[model samples]
Target: MGKVTGFMEFERLKEASEAPESRVKHYKEFVVTLTDSEAKIQGARCMDCGIPFCNNGCPVNNIIPDFNDLVYRQDWQNALETLHSTNNFPEFTGRICPAPCEAACTLGINEDPVGIKSIEHAIIDKGWANGWVVPKPAAQKTGKKVAVVGSGPAGLAAAQQLARVGHDVTVFEKNDRIGGLLRYGIPDFKMEKTHIDRRVEQMQAEGVTFKAGVFVGEKLVEGGITNLAKESISPKELMAQFDAVVLTGGSEVPRDLPVPGRQLKGVHFAMDFLPLQNRVNAGDKLKDQILATKKNVLVIGGGDTGSDCVGTSNRHGAKQVVQIELMPQPPEHENKPLVWPYWPMKMRTSSSHEEGVERDWAVTTKEFIDDGKGNVRAAKCAKVEWVKDEATGQMKMQEVAGSEFEIPADLVLFAMGFTNPAKSILDAFGVEKDNRGNAKATTDGEGCYRTNVDKVFAAGDMRRGQSLVVWAIREGRQAAREVDQYLMGATVLPR
Candidate 1:
């Protein structure tokens, strides 16, 4: 809208990245931001699409065109404001979100989509640099108390919103730090913890309390998942103390491969391996840090978690890294006519994959070969073909005859994604669960976000299953509104 022919004039320019060889040496953000002029040019590329599919495509429904117009007009302050209007943590989403908004961009039907995420990153970074991001404490206290369990995006978003609405909000985290997966699951190389720290400081100023190292239910049983809780509060105690409780805990139960030799020492869940590096990055001394140094690493699963393992392994100076996917490889380019205005299925090579990794698709692990001493030595795998069944019209995976193979793997990390939230917390609250094991909570109608138990709400990954951070924020904001309405008889908070 800023420039009528800007989309035709400017080609999409992605943010520069540090060379894999150099960036792998340290765990720090390597994606460089666009200069002011570059960002402005990118902003100008946004077309005045009537539908604004990017808005709907974004999980948090970001006002993309408004921010783009603001940036193009050199209104950085307004751009930041527009960005913050929808996303509570643009810095987090700007860095890690897959940018489905771009995929749904009108321009992307034939041409490259506008660099929306980069513009967002620039606006938010500029906002912080210019001290535009500050606390907006509530005007008056509401005389109500709310408890938010889990300090990830959802819990943090809900806590901030509830606190800003004049309610006393306390966010409880099982880990020693505030950020849940953001602080532990994600590698520091993608996003530094300082972003979370500053937000925590701002939230604190906004009348939200953060109680780190406080588990709200039973102790976590997962071996690698971090839990620094010195004290545990039962659901009964939390219900007795707070007016309402919001369960925003993440989906922490990782899906496991129960193949032969899964009990091997070096065959670990990705959660167990990832958090250790995060702890080490935080300067925590650990006697047993899982290392990939000089080890042949095999990362199973082809999602973001697997890509993270690839990056971390490279940083650990792994001898070799191989990433496997159960599904067949997607097309390198999407058919625009067939998948316009929606997320397209295509090959996505992450920065980690580019760094160095042997990737195999449509492959399944048959067994983790164990050394006599009990450590994983290799992985026996087989290539499979996906065939459509005529009866059910479902795709079935069939192993190719004589396609069995083995790869040297001293350290095998299973990054196949999470199945559900830790059942202990959900059971502690007596919250109903969907068939998928996520906390059962509706997203619309009168009882939205309200669990079967009175005065209890569920949001984010805990309610919707594992999803994008932007979705988590959206759920959190919506849940906050529902909680506020339930508390005060009505609410004015934006959904």
Candidate 2:
């Protein structure tokens, strides 16, 4: 609305990226930030639509148009304020979140959508550089202690919010670092770890205590899916010590391919491989590290996790990288009229894919060939066709006859996504689980966020299953509000 005719005058301008060849040499963020002028022009492209669907499209419901207008008018301070009002870590979302808000933009129906994510990146980066981002400690302490399990985006957001509202907050992390998945799951090439480190410093200044390397409840069910915890705390001790406990632990049970030769040594879950590389990048020494150097790497499951594997493998100088998807390929472009204002099912290519990866769709792995030394040598795969059944109108996949093939792959990483939270922790706490195995908890009304046990709550992937970082932040913020209300009989914290 800052410039009424700006949408018609300006085209979407994406942030510049480092060349693939040059970027793959090291693990660091390579996205070139937009200059102030470019960001202002991009922000000016926001139109005055009667309804701002981009707001609702964003998982955190970011005030897109307001921030855009602020940026367009050179009100950078207010823009940062508006961004931080809803999002505790816009820098993280700006770096890694797939902008669903842009897909739902009003202008995207006929033209390129506003570069909202770029503008957000500029705003937050500027905020940090200008010392505009600082800790907000409560003036009065509530004397109520809150424990947040898991220090990922959700747990961090909840801890920050509760701490700001005068409650004593302690974050428990299994890993040595504060960030759970952000510190390990995401490669530094996508987002450097310094962003999380700075936030941790700010939170600490706000009276939030971080207990890293301390595992709450029992051990993780799936070994190698996470960094092993050196210290352990029982659920009974946590419940008895803290006034309230919020389980923001993410879903960590990775889906496995139970085909022949799954026991091969070279076949590993993406989590097991990814975390090790991150540790090495963080200057930790590992006796054994999963290396893709000079090996033909096969990444199963075409998703963000798979793309990440492609990038990390390239960084490790893999001989070749091939990514496979079980489902049929989606249309490169979606029919906007049919899927406007909602996330469309269209083919998405990440920067990692651009770094050089042979991608295939509608293919399924049949077996992992062994090298006779308990190691995977190659993967046997087959092409599949999806057809709609006339009786039920449901599509099913069938392998094509004579389409079986084998590809050389000394290393295989399973990035097929997670099924649910680790079962052992939930069982140790005696928390009820939904049919999907996620922690069973309501999101509204009485007993919101309250688990079966008194003073216990669940949020993020622990309650809703595997999801985006933005969704995790939203869940954590809302759960913090509920916890506050439950303890104080009222809360000023926003939901």
Candidate 3:
């Protein structure tokens, strides 16, 4: 610990952000990074706890105390090194990971947790500015070929690791861009695309080839999953050409509400609406982009995706935005004694929610009301309560007797989370799936991450179902180690 008693002396300071009214006017990153002195104080707040549960709390197990100490001592470069040693993209996680590590911090039990995410943001941004982040090409070539499907966080981490270890890695992305979700799913207001672009340049310099607009499956995916592939590759061809194949595609199958009037023209999935705006922001002219302008927008689902919808709708100059959740609202604050050192269920308000939105919970949509022109006009909803069934000993939802209502809505976005990965890719590779429709793969023991088909592996969301980007990176790095061992009979890569 750089400063043993610093935690007791310093107070937590949040990163400054653009005001809600000012930030919603455009699509760009609004949160300003902590200054050098501010970051040092934030880092100094890390208590010298005996056991660093923050490390375990983090999905990628970042060396929190070490980095905090380094930052506190003004060793910025070493802090960046420690951060990159665990997380492939601190910029991504620092911006959108929700900071589970902070929730598990010892200081959080009694006081505000250390601003670890802010320190990380400062370290990475400083690293890039000072040219500390650069290409780390391999010392020697292994002469082995690897194919990574999906260019999201997981696939990118795996490809970077394998490439650094002297293997020829080619990443296949179905979209015209490299980053699968980071490029399209996340709004630019949260993180700019330049971050992903620079990483692509660095990976290319490290000898990792990126083939965009190329689908690596027998057939192209349809429906909600975006597939801008100009070419398709068969599984047999990929197996014959590459020594190993890793499936790191995201969970793209969005959960749908199969209520009445679901066929309305103005009702769409969040994916179908979000990516268009991103593409437009990237200077891709879209002919028929979905707009929330001058419309009363209804966002169903109360997760990050729904919050994102709220932000985007506000940016589009929407007339009004109302977000609803089927589940009851959680407490504003969690009971720390009961849920310490673990993620707790509580009311979370995002920057999008702060902009402007009418938020409601425990309301279920019964149907999408249709206008005369086959467009969504409103949503009929009802309040519901969770009651325990004595016979079954399970909680079930029941609608209130006289709580039915309707809200005006010209645009309805289904922001409910994704269910599973596209079925076509897994079926093409002959990989088995678990009961949840995710690719069946273990995380420990022998031959971990290997799929049923020979030379085929699964990782990230494809294997673990829909999850955080940090988890995706962890699985990707682990899967790379497994694939390397399988090929070279040994691996120096970390798990």
lDDT of 2 by residue, 1-495 (tens): 789999999989999999999999999999999999999999999998999999999999999999999999999999999999999999999999999999999999999999999999999999999999999999999999999999999999999999999999999998888899999999999999999999999999999999987888754323353856778889989988999999999888899999999999899999989989999999999988999999999999999999999999999999999999999999999999899989999999899999999999999999999999899999999999999999999999999999999989999999999999978778888999999999999998898888998899999999999999999999999999999998999999887
Residue ranges of candidate 3 with Cα displaced over 4 Å: 221-225
lDDT of 3 by residue, 68-144 (tens): 99999999999999999999899999998999999999999989999988999999999999999999999999999
**Model 1 residue 29 lDDT?**
96
Residue 489 deviation, candidate 2, in Å?
1.1
User: Residue 220 error for model 3, in Å?
Assistant: 3.9
Error of 1 at 459 (Å): 0.4
**TM-score of predicted structure 3:** 0.99
In angstroms, the error of model 1 at 240 is 0.7
- The TM-score values for the models, in the order shown, are 0.99, 0.98, 0.99
Candidates in descending TM-score order: 3, 1, 2
Q: How many backbone overlaps does candidate 3 show?
A: 0
